[model samples]
Target: MAIPGYDSGNVAEFALERAGARAEVVAGVVPDEFGLERSGRDPTATALADAVEFVGLEELRAVDAFRIELVYDPSALPPGASPTDVGIAVETDDGWERLESTVDLEATTVSATLGGRPSGSTIVAIYDGTGES
Candidate 1:
């Protein structure tokens, strides 16, 4: 939902899109620093931090024969014209860690690649929420 050219109200709307890549975006958390402020008039103002991180992942596995393709519309989900960092959790026999790769956000979609993720059984998840990105 969080398209490069769009900025909604929620940070989860942001997605990590790539090509020829297999992976899932997990734990996406955008901690916007919110603080109370006092001015000459209104004493109820808050500051927000503009940062991006993984909050959730569709989930993937080479053992479960699981693969998916993420294709959804990022229409006004996270209304912003900036690219966000995508984090992922790769499931393996040795527990899990952070997945390192490139996630490019196109004009209409997002894609990702995870260590040359399994072919054929590719899984793609697109933003399908009616909210803004």
Candidate 2:
């Protein structure tokens, strides 16, 4: 299995929102492993209990993929929203636009296959609902 980890979104941004702290996010592919790994770590927890990771995607196509891990935190969620309501958005030359993707509550992450080759400079916004900011 030639599963390659795709560079998709900002790890810091995703971890901050999930951990609600200046947490650490681990990204990149594992050596000799065919899968993408992402995690949001809370130092206070000091373990994977409060952390979130997404793995085992078949492949990455055009565009980019983001694994947003939003733990069950009432404060992190806006009114009328739940952890499962997490959404994905991307910033293009036109402006901030909505990108369709899949969300896995079990994994506590949202994954998207975008249509452009996003570099480190690409801006990816993971927000709640289809709201405009």
Best by lDDT: 2
lDDT of each: 0.28, 0.35
Candidate 2, residue 108: lDDT: 51
lDDT of 1 at 112: 42
Whole-model lDDT, candidate 1?
A: 0.28
Model 2 lDDT, full chain set = 0.35
How well is each residue in 66-94 modelled by candidate 2, as lDDT tens digits? 33323333345556765445544433456
**Can you tell me which runs of candidate 2 are displaced by over 4 Å?**
1-74, 131-133
How many angstroms is residue 65 displaced in model 2 relative to the true structure, after the best TM-score fit? 8.9
Q: Per-residue lDDT for 1-133 in model 1, tens only?
A: 2223323432122223323222222223323331111112211111011112222222322222212223333343345523333322333345333333233456332344333233322122222222222
Error of 1 at 88 (Å): 6.9
Off by over 4 Å in 1: 1-69, 81-104, 116-133
Q: Ten residues in a row with the worst lDDT in model 2? A: 40-49
